[model samples]
Target: MSDKKTLQEIEKEHRDSHFAEKSMQYWRSWGSWFSWGSPVGLGLFFIETAVAAWIVAQIVK
Candidate 1:
């Protein structure tokens, strides 16, 4: 029998050959910053609020 690749197999081989994978996709690195930024910003806001309250209390004492 003659050896031959099917259309699907040939297409798969072509697709695999042209595969492009970026170690860092567009804005992928900034993804972590976005994910972590909300929590960090919230934490800072709470800290600032607490400090402001404490300062006001101390001043009123």
Candidate 2:
């Protein structure tokens, strides 16, 4: 371990080296799931509930 490097210096160096790639990787991973898959998932859930409600209505009537 180099005793000359301060904590802030080490942190700054690590952040500079990894921040962009790490941030981009995280955003890219979530972006597709949130933008596309979430809506599809929600739509399926809604349709399923609607169908259940229709079945209940038919049974009651």
**Global lDDT of each candidate:** 0.73, 0.84
Candidate 2 stretches with Cα past 4 Å from truth are 1-37
Clashes of each: 0, 0
Name model 1 segments beyond 4 Å from true.
Answer: 1-37
Candidate 1 C-alpha error for residue 34, in Å: 8.7
Residue-wise lDDT of candidate 1 within 13-45, one digit each (tens)? Answer: 877666533435545765655553677656767
TM-score for each predicted model, relative to the true structure: 0.41, 0.41
TM-score of 1: 0.41
Model 2 C-alpha RMSD to native = 6.6
